[model samples]
Target chain A: MESRNLFMRMLMHAVIIIMVLIWVVPTLGILISSIRPASDVLNTGWWTVFKSPLEVTQFTVENYESIIERAGMGTAFRNSVIIASVGTLLPVTTAAFAAFGFSRLNFWGKRFLFGIIIGLIVVPLQMTFIPVLRVYHQVGLSGTFLGVWLAHTAYGLPFAVFMLHNFFSALPRDLFEAAYIDGASLLSVFFRIALPLSVPALASLIIFQFLWVWNDLLVSLIYLGGTRDVAPLTVRLASLVGSYGQDWHLLTAAAFISIVVPVVVFIGLQKYFVRGILAGSVKS
Target chain B: MAGVTLENVTKRFGDVVAVKEATLEVPDQDFLVLVGPSGCGKTTTLRMVAGLEDITEGKIKIGEKVVNDLPPKDRDIAMVFQNYALYPHMNVFNNMGFGLKLRKIPRDEITKRVKEAAKLLGIENLLDRKPAQLSGGQRQRVALGRAIVRNPQVFLMDEPLSNLDAKLRVQMRAELSKLHDRLKTTIIYVTHDQTEAMTMGDKIVVQNEGVIQQVAPPLTLYNEPENMFVAGFIGSPAMNFIKVKLRREDEDFFVDGADLNLKLSSALLDKRPGIKEYANQDVIMGIRPEDLGDAQVEKEFQVSDDNSFTADVEVVEPLGSEISLYFKIGDISGIARVDADSKARVGDKIKLACNTEKIHLFDRETEEAIK
Candidate 1:
């Protein structure tokens, strides 16, 4: 019996190792390809660099320097940061409160209203693009950061509320009841108990929304009108790739630069997700 | 500091009534326990009093004001749930102080009150730790300390010790009783454990199926249950109930039941002369196991042919101090808790003496005590 159990554990470990390698190998290739000199990258395979892993002459920062200084990705980088931060913050804050209200409070049409909001997750994003674009044009929000942020928030809200509402509602009902009986107002209960314990759920959500907004090309392209001035890195990068598809060396540098923020956010929030934030709030 | 009055309070969830017309006046500084089996509306009644559940039909008064429509926060009560419900993010100090902080009390006062409560609960060393870092017993103390810091008008606890291990539960039971004595505050506690109710409560309300079965002190509830349900529920092993016919002859009263005929003691007749009216009618006789003894063992109660019943012992469960003799008189089964020295064994025909003065009779039809 112990041998059978050990065999099963070893099998699971092998399968997981294979899965991790499948995901990580491509990203590792990208890192190596980004740093190699453009001439060497286009000629030799990326794996060839591992033959002499410590050689410094084959690697150079010129590709990155060229993309940031010459291609105007610098401005796009700044724009993406602003757009993603506001986009992530606005929807997350609104959704957290809405989710809390949906979970805890009583009001007329509450379930019906929540159903309508959640039902939006099933609707295709393509169907609403034209109508939302027309609204943006009339409101003079076209080609602006605000236009894209609102669009991201609107597109992202239903899923955010869906995820957060489930998390908040699943929290021990007794904890909230205890707080109310302890003489806390609703806001106090939310800020003190619900919000704090929801950090793990909220962290995963931040990682999710931040990545979505950062990587988005279609929404920013449509709402920001494909203009270079207010366009984020995704829009600008797509345009650069279109205009100069052969500039793989600079594109590699741009791709790596674009991914830096999300990796940091994931790593920072990773610890929160690991710990059991609801521990000791109820029976262990 | 204040009493809570519930006047015909009824709670309904759509069509299913959870608590029906529960009327109780919990006096100031009294520890009143609402106890019953699960889903018996004991917790529902406590929730209604805490203003967590809205009273659908009647009014609730906390002190002099009707608080039927008040939110839980405005009701000015502190509750410790079965689950500790400690805030996961806060350290012990903050978990205890959060309520005071919400009331905009001065920082120093909040600190003092939380620290004082921590000291009282012997959790001062744990004030820096989060609840998740503590053991189950410590978490319970943190929950208790959270309530104590508020010093609310009333304390409502819903099986706070039910989560602890048996030994810890027993210890916490004594500590809670001590806390009540020290605080002298009105507390409406809810638990399904009759032992907790009997050991701690100044008054106990036994509920079953959203209806109050009986409300009295522990001894009174045990010795003089209002109904068969209360009589059966309050005792540990439960009272043995047998159907018997009452007979009256001149000035004496007797009950004829299953191979045994016992004359009602004159003392019981004086206490409940209503037995005279039950003559020739069948009644339910309830006898606690402890009220019976081995006829061979020397005891205070008299032993005679009229009071002793011969039965075949089926099982003998012997504890160090006493023994439980399970036996059958004809087809009626009963248990007799007798002296440890009794020689009663399995399959032995042993005589058991029942203390007739301690027996209880109920009208079989109504199932209520024949007072």
Candidate 2:
């Protein structure tokens, strides 16, 4: 039985190794391609650079420098950060309050209101683009950073309210009652009891909303009108690829540059992701 | 500091009635317990008093003012829930001091009160630790300390010790009794455990369904139950009930029940003059387990044959100082608590003496005491 268990463990390890290699190989290729000299990248496979052990000439920072200086990649990076922060923060705060009210407070038409929000989830954002764009145009928000932030918050709210509501409602009713008896008003209970206990759920939502907003090109392109000043990393990268489709080295460097923030955010907050997803499943 | 009076308070959730017109007067400095089986609405009554649930049909006065329109915070009461309900994010000091801080009490005063409460609960060393880091008993202390630091007009506890292990529950039970003495505040406690209700409460309100059953001191409740339900609910192993008939043969009166006959003591008849109305009709007879003993062991009770009956002992549970004997007489089953020195064994026939004075009679239809 012990030997059979050992055999099962070894088979599981082998499968995991194969899965990791499948995921890491392409990412390693892009990273190696991003730093190589343009001629070396085009003339030979990215694998050939690894064959030369420590040849100093095989690597250069010119691709990253060119992307930053000539392509206005730095501005794009700053724009992505601003959009993601505002986009993630506004929806999470509003949704948390909405979720608390939906979960804990009693009001007339609560179920119907919540049902309307859930119904919104099934309607694709593409269906609202024309209407939302018309509204933005009338309000003079069509080509502004605030327009994209508002768009992201509107798009992000339904799922955020739905997810955080489940977490907040699943909390023990006794905690809120104890707080109320401890002389807390409804708002204090939301800020002190409900929000503190919802850190795991909030962290997962932040990662999810931040990554989505950071990587989005379509919404920003339509709402921000593809302006050079307001275009995010995603829009900038798309424009770079349009002009330099065959410039693999610069494209790889710009792609890597665009992905850096999301990778860091995901890695830093990865622990909360597992816990938050499991929050509704486990009892406590 | 203040008494709570509920006048015909009722709570209805949609179509179901959770508490039906519960009216109780919890005097200042009284530890009144509301106890019943699960789903008996004891917790519902407590919640209504705390203003967590709206009183659908009555007035609740915490002191001089009617508090039906007040929210829980404005009602000036503190509650300890069954689950303890300590804030998971806050350490012990903050958890205990949260209510004071919410009331806008000064920083150092909140500190002093929290420290004093922590010392009272022996949780001073644990003040820096979050609730998640504490054991179950420690969390219970923190919950109690939270209520204590508030020093509200009344304290409400809902089965606070039910979450602890049996030993810890007993320890906390005594500590809570002492805390009540020191604080001298009105407390409305709710528990389903009758032992807790009997031990900790100055007065216990027994409930069944949504209706209050009996309200009296614990010993009075034990010795003089108002109905069959209270008799069965108050004691461990419960009071054994048997169908019996009362007959008057010439000048003497006798009660006849399954393979047994007993001459009624004149003293009993004198105390319950109304028992004459139940003569020659079926009535329920209740006898506590401790009221029956081995006829051979209890010679001092003067076990005359008229007051004794034979039964086949089916089970003997020796509990060191005393033994519980399960026996059957004809078609009726009964239990006797006898001295451990008794030689009765399972499958043996033994004569059991009945303390005729201790037997209770209830109306078959109304289930009320004959007296």
Candidate 3:
């Protein structure tokens, strides 16, 4: 029995290690290839670095400096930060209020309204682009920050409301009723009690939205118009790949540059990300 | 600080009625308990008064103003829920002072009132701790302190101590009574536990199936229940109901069952003017367990054949101070709370006496008492 238990534990560890390597290996390859010179990257695989452990001379910062200076990666990086921050904030704020109403309050057409919102998740974003772009043009918001924020918020809301509604509805009903009787209005209860207790859910949604918007090329390209000033990191990176497809070292460095903000965000919000997922599954 | 009156209040959800035309008056500083078994609408009635639930039909008044359309906040009420719904994000002081702060009270006053309520609940040192850090008993006290700090017109408690263990529930029960006396605020409490109802309520409302069965002081409710439901619901062992036919045998009334016959005194019949009308008709004879004891060990009442009978004991439960003897009286099972000294054992035949003056007879059809 003891030997069988040891075998089972070892098998579980092996499975987990395999899964982690599957995700981490590609990211590690990008990181290693980003620092290598253009000739070295084209000639050898990323794993060849172990053949000469002390080959410090093989590494170069020229690819990073050239990407930032010539490809205008710095401005793209700032634009990505602004767009993602606004996009994440807009959807999360609106979704929290909508989720509170959907879960806690009762009114006519409540079920019908929630059913419609949830049903909208099935609508493809590609299908709405032409019509949404026309509306944005008529309103003179196209190629602007407000237009991108609005677009991202609309794309993010349905799923955000769906996830947050699950968390908010699972909270004890007695707490809301007690607050009401304790002299709190509906909005006050939403702000003071619901919002505070829901930090984990909000943080996770922020991470999800911020990462999605930061990495998006298609939405930002269509809505923000791929211009030098308005283009985000994803658009610039995609354009770099299109214009200079042969520059493997610069492409790797640019790809790594675009991922930096998302990595920092995931790490910063990682504590809440795990807890929020578990909280939805467990009874408090 | 003021009374609450509900007039012809009814609540319906979709097609099912939860509370039906419930009328009640809770006077100032009174502890009124609404108690019944589960799904009896006791909690619904309390919620309706608190303005947490919509009253489907009638008007509810806090003090003198009708609050039918008012939200819970405008109704000047505080509710302590069964699970002690303290804000998980806030510490004890903040939880207690949340209501006062919402009312726009000054920071110093909120602090003072919170400290005062914590001191009153003997949780002064725990004011800084969040609800998740407290024990179940302490959480319950914080829930109570939240209500106490509000100083609302009324307090609505929905089984606040039901989450505690039996020992803690008893301790909290006494502490709640003391809290009520000190606060002098009108409180409407709901629970399914009869002991809490009997010990803490100034007036008890016994409800079943969304209708109020009887509302009276504690002892009056226990002794003079209006119907068979109240009689059976109020007591611990529950009142034994025996279906018997009332027959007139030479001017003396006798209750006759399949295998048992017992006589009723003429004086007892004279006192109950409606007893003659039940002659030759089937009636439910309700006898409490304490009213039935070993005839051989009796002291006060007359143990004649009119109220004494022999039954074979089926089970004996010794409770130290007293023994509960379960026996079959004719076709129906009955229990007798007798002195522990009685030498009664299972399957032994023993004579039991009923307190004739304390007997309750209910109509077979309506189940109402035949006064």
Candidate 4:
């Protein structure tokens, strides 16, 4: 039994190691290739550089510098930050209030309203893009940061409300009753008790919304019209691989930049995401 | 500090009635307990009084003011839930002072009241600790302190000790009685444990199936249960029920049953003339375990007949001061509480005497006491 257990453990470890290599190898290759000179990258694979570390002639910071100064990546980076921040803030705030109402408050047609919200979860984003663009054009909101923010917020709300509603519902009913008996009004209870205790859920939602908005290219293009001034990093990166599809260096640099914020957000809020997911899944 | 009255209060959830039309008066400074089995609506009644539950069809008055529509906070009542619903996010001091703070009491006054309540509950040193940091008993005390600091018109407790271990439950039960005495506040307590009800309540209300069975002092309830349910519910080990028929021998009445024939005492006969109408009719004879003991067969108090038969002991449980003998007479099994030192063994045939005066006679059809 002991030997069989040890064999099983070894098999599991081997499988995990292979899976990790599959995921990490390409990312590692990209990092090495991004720093190496364009000639070295074209001459040999990233692995060849490892054979002669003292050569020093293989490396260069020119790709990063050129991507920023010549390729207009700085403006794109700034636009991504503003869009992601506003997008995250807008969805999370509306979702929190909507979730609390759906979970706690009772009014006419509450179940039907919540059912409509849940149904929206299955509606494809592509199907709504034209209609939304038309509405934005009529309202004079197209090709603007505000229009992009609204579009992202609308697209993000269904799942956000679903995630947060389950968390809000799982909270002990006694806590709300205690607050009520303590003479806390509905708004006070929501602000002081509900919101404070919901940090894990809120953190996870913020991370999710931020990453989705930051990586998105389609919605930003449709609503913001790919204007250089308002275009986010994703649209700018798409433009890097031009209509002719050349310039891999600029494309890779922009892709890395776009990936940076999401990675940071994920690493920072990973614990809360795990906890929030479990909290929503479990009954209590 | 104030009286609470529920006038024909009823609650329903869709098609099911949770609490029937129930009227109760909790007098000023009285400790009243509502005791029954689970789903008996005791907690619902208490919640209705606290204004946590809305009355479906009647009036609720607190201190002579109609409070049926008032919310729990405006009802001036504090409740300690069975789970000790202390705020998990707050320290003990903040949890206790929360109501006062909501009422906009001065900060120093809230602190003073919180400290006093903590002192009274003997949890002064633990005020800085969160509820999660406290033990079960300490959390229960914090829940009580939260109620205490409010200084409300009434205190409603819903089985606050039911979550504790057996030893802690006993200790907390006594402490709660003492607390009530010291505070002299009108309190409505709910529990399914009859022992807690009997020991702590100045007046106990026994309920079952959403109906109030009996409401009286514990001793009165024990001595004169209005029905078979009350008789069996209020006593430990429960009242032993024997299916019997009332028969008259000459002028004296006797209860005849399987393996037993007993004469009804004159005291019971005079008080219960209704038994005369039940002669030769099926009736239930309820004898508490403690009322049966060993006796000389020839004693004048012994009412003998050919129906008296021997029974073999099935088990004997010694409870330090008393031994409970479980025996079977034919197919009918019963328990008898005897002296602890009695030499009784399993499978031994020991004749036990029944106290005729203490036996309760109930109409078999209605399951109500014959009075």
Candidate 5:
């Protein structure tokens, strides 16, 4: 029985290792290719680096410099940061209040309103673009960073409310009631008690919204337009592949560059990320 | 610190009424407990008093001010919830001081009050620890400290010690009584536990199905329950109820049940002379476990046939100090708390004597006591 159990465990671990390698190996290849010179990348595959692993001359900073200094990657990166930050902040702030209201407050149309939000989660974003863009144009926001932030906020609000609502609702009701009796106004309770206890949920939500907006291609392309001034990392990368389809080295460099912020965000927020899967709540 | 008066307070949730026209007056500094089994609206009534729940109809006055329109924050109350409800992220110091801080009290004053409360609860050393780091009893203390720091006009506790172990609950029960004595604040406590009500309440209000069954001082409520529900609910090993026909044999009053007949003592008749009116009809006799004893090991009461009945013992529960002898006096199962030395065992017929002086008689239909 011990031998059979050991064999089964080994088999399961082998499957897991293979799955991790499948995801990690390609990312590792892209990282290596991004540093290799355009001439060397054109000459041989990224795996050939093992032949002369100690040859530092094979690596170059030229691809990165070319992508940033020459190909407008710097502005695109900056634009992505601004858009994603504002987008994440706008939605999360609105969603937290909406979630608390939906979960904790009583109003005449509460059930109907929450039901509508649940229904809206299934509505496709692509279907709302044209009408939203019309309003965007009328407000002269058709091709701006603010336009993309607004669009992403609208796109993200439904799920954000749904996720935070479940988390907020799971928080014991006694805490809120206790706060009320302790002489805290509703706003005070929301800010001091509810929000503080909900750190993990909010942090994970920030990571989700930030990452989604950072990597989003469709919304930025449609709402902000593909201009050099307003284009994000994603749109720029797509354009790099479109206009310079043969520049594999630069595309590889751009790919690695685009992922840097999201990777840092995930790692920075990773501790809070999984802890909120079950709301670690007050005792009550 | 002031009294709270609720006049005709009724709470309704849609169509279902949770509290029905409950009227109560809690004088200043009294520990009033609302207790009943689950779903009996005890917690609902306490919440209504705290202004955490709205009164659907009626006036609730804190002192002389009608507070039906006041929010909980404006009602000058503090509540300790069953699970403590300590802010999980805050340390003990911050948890206790959070409400005062919100009230915009000076920093030093808040700290001073928090420290004093911590010292009072004997948790000064634990002030730096978060609620997650504290033991269940310690968390309960922190919850109490939080309420104490508020020093509100009224303290509302909803089964605050129900989460603790049995031993800790007893210890906390005593500590809470001491806290109440020291703080001198009106407290409206809610629990389903009868022991806590009996041990801590200055006045106990027994509720059943959203209606107040009886409200009186602990011993009075226990000894003279207004109805059968209160009589059954107030005691542990609750009062045994036997349906009996009250017979008037000249001046002597007798309660006759299946295989059981007991002449009502003159002392009970003097307190409740109305029992004579129900002489030819059926009534229910309520007796506590301790009120019945082994006739063979008798003490003060005489072992005459009028107050003694023979039955085969069905079970014997030895509780160290005393033994609970279980038997059937007909279809009705009865328990007698007899001295541990009584020689009663399962299957042996034992003659149990009822304490006629302490017998309670109630109407058969309404279940109300004969006053």
Candidate 6:
């Protein structure tokens, strides 16, 4: 029996190693290609640099320079930051309050309202594009940052509410009751106890919402319009790889720049992400 | 400190009644314990008093005011949950001072009260440490300190010692009693452990199926249990029950069961004239293990002349000063407590004597104590 268990462990390790290589190799290639000069990148495979240390002299920062200065990448980067920050902030704050009400407060039709919210999670985002665009146009919000913010906030609400409500519901009921007995009103308990204790869940949700909005293209293009000054990195990067699709160097640099914020955010909040995900699920 | 009264308190969840019309008066400065098996609504009763749970159909009064519609904060009560419910994010001082701060007490006063509570609980050094950093016993002390800092009119605790280890539970039990004495505050504690109920409570309310079985001082509840439930619940190893028939042998009445017979005491017989109604009917005979002694002592008393029963010892458990002998008499198996020096062994024949005055008689059908 022990031999069988050991055999299973060995097989699992092999599968995991293979999966990690599959995900890591291409991203490593893009990073190496983005650093190397366009001539050397097109000439030799990125693997050759690992075998010869002297070959690293072929590396250049020109691809990054052109992407940032000539392609208006700086403006797109700022636009992406604005949209993603607002997108994450608005949804998460609203969701926290709404989720608390769904989980803790006693109200008429609470279960039914929560059921409708959960049901919304399964609805495809593509189905709401036209109807939401029409509303944005009627409300004089089209072609503005507020328009894209509203669009992303609407798209993010269902999942945000679902995740946070499940988390809020899992907290020990005794803790809330203790706060209530300690002379805290419902709003006070929410701000003082529930919100503070839910840092981990909030951190993870911030990472998720920030990443999704950062990498978004369709919603930004549709709501904020294809204006060069207002378009996010995703839209600008898509235009860089236009009909000819030949600027691999510029594409790689721009993509890497776009990926940096989320990676940094993930690394910063990783501890809380792991803890918040499991806090209310188990005793430990 | 103030007393709490629950009059006709009933709590229901859908179709199930959790606390059924419980009426209790917890006097000021008294340590009252509500004890029962799990699902007996002991915790529910405590929560209702804390206003954590709403009473379905009843009125609750704390210190002369009807507080049925008041929130827990307005009720001026402090509670220690079974899990301690210490705020994990806060240090011991902050957790204890949180209530005072919420009440908008001045900063210096809050600090003083928190420090005083910490000193009283002997957790002053742990004031800066979070609950997660503290051991189970330390966390329980912090919980108590949190309650004390509030200086509320009443204190409610729900199985506060249950999460601790056996040795820690015993240690904490004494500390809690001492804390109660020093504070002199009305406290309503709940536990499933009968030992806690017997040891800590000035007045113990024994409950079963959401109904109060009996409520009295610890000794009164132990010595004069109102029903079979109270009798069986109060004692360790439990009181033994035997099915017996009340039989009239000439002018005297006797209890006749399988492999045993006992002459009824005249005082017991006279006190319960209802036994005449069951002259030849089945009855329950209850006897605590300690009530039985060595047969040699039985010769002096005529009332115990018919109390001798022969049995084979199935097991002998030596517990320091006393030995518990698990023995069998025909089809009936029971335990008897004897001196530790007794030479009783498994499979050995022994004759035991019963204390006639300590025997309890109950009607078989109703299970109510006859005397």
| Fnat, 2 decimals, each candidate | 0.92, 0.92, 0.90, 0.54, 0.90, 0.77
In candidate 6, which residue pairs get closer than 3 Å at backbone N, Cα or C atoms, i.e. clash?
Answer: none
In the range A130-196, model 1's lDDT, one tens digit per residue, is 9988998899998888888888888889998888888887888998988888777889889988998
Per-residue lDDT of A72-106 in model 5, one digit per residue for the tens?
A: 99999999999999999999999999999999999
Query: What level of docking quality does candidate 2 show?
Result: high
**Candidate 4, B1-371: lDDT as tens digits:** 69988888899988889889888898999999999999999999998887777788989898989998888888888989998878788899999998898899999999999999999999999999998899999999999999999998899999999999999999999999999999999999999999999999999999999988999999999999999999999988888888988899877888877777888888888877878888888899998988876443323355355223356889999999888888786677888887676787898887777777888999888899998
Residue B32 in model 1: shift from native, Å? 1.3
Q: In candidate 3, which residue ranges exceed 4 Å CA deviation?
A: A1-6, A42-58, B299-302
Candidate 1's C-alpha runs over 4 A off are A1-18, A47-57, A274-284
By DockQ, the best candidate is 2
lDDT of 4 at A271: 87
Give TM-score values for chain A, per-prediction. 0.93, 0.96, 0.93, 0.92, 0.94, 0.92
Q: Candidate 5 versus the native: TM-score?
A: 0.97
Comparison by lDDT, 1 against 4, better one: 1
What residue runs in model 5 are displaced by over 4 Å at the alpha carbon? Answer: A1-12, A279-284
Instruction: Show how many residue pairs clash in every candidate, following the order shown.
Output: 0, 0, 0, 0, 0, 0
Candidate 4, residues A41-104, lDDT tens digits: the string is 7678888877987888777778889888887888999999999999999999999999999999
lDDT of 3 by residue, A1-284 (tens): 99999999999999999999998999889988999988999999988998996989978898999999999998999899899999999999999999998999888999999999999899999999999999999999999999999999999999999999999998999988888887888889999989999989988999989989998999999999989898999999888989989998899899999887899999999999998877568887
Better of 4 and 5 by lDDT: 5
The alpha-carbon deviation from the true structure for residue A19 of candidate 6, after best TM-score superposition, in angstroms, is 6.3
Given candidate 6, what's the lDDT at residue B21?
96
Per-residue lDDT of model 5, residues B195-311, tens digit only: 999999999999999999988999999899999999999998989999999999999999998788899999889989999999879999999999999999978678898888998
Q: Write the per-residue lDDT of candidate 3 for residues B1-371, one digit (tens) a residue.
A: 89989899999989988899989999989999999999999999998888878889988998999999998899888899999999999999999999999899999999999999989999999999999999999999999999988888899999998999999999999999999998899999999999999999999999999999999999998888899999999988999899989998777788888566778766678778788888899998988999988988887687887788889999999999999999996677988899878899999989998887778889999999997
Complex DockQ per candidate? 0.80, 0.90, 0.80, 0.60, 0.82, 0.77
lDDT of 3 at B312: 91
- C-alpha lDDT values of all predictions: 0.89, 0.91, 0.91, 0.86, 0.92, 0.88
- Give the winner by DockQ: 3 or 4: 3
Clashing pairs in 1: none
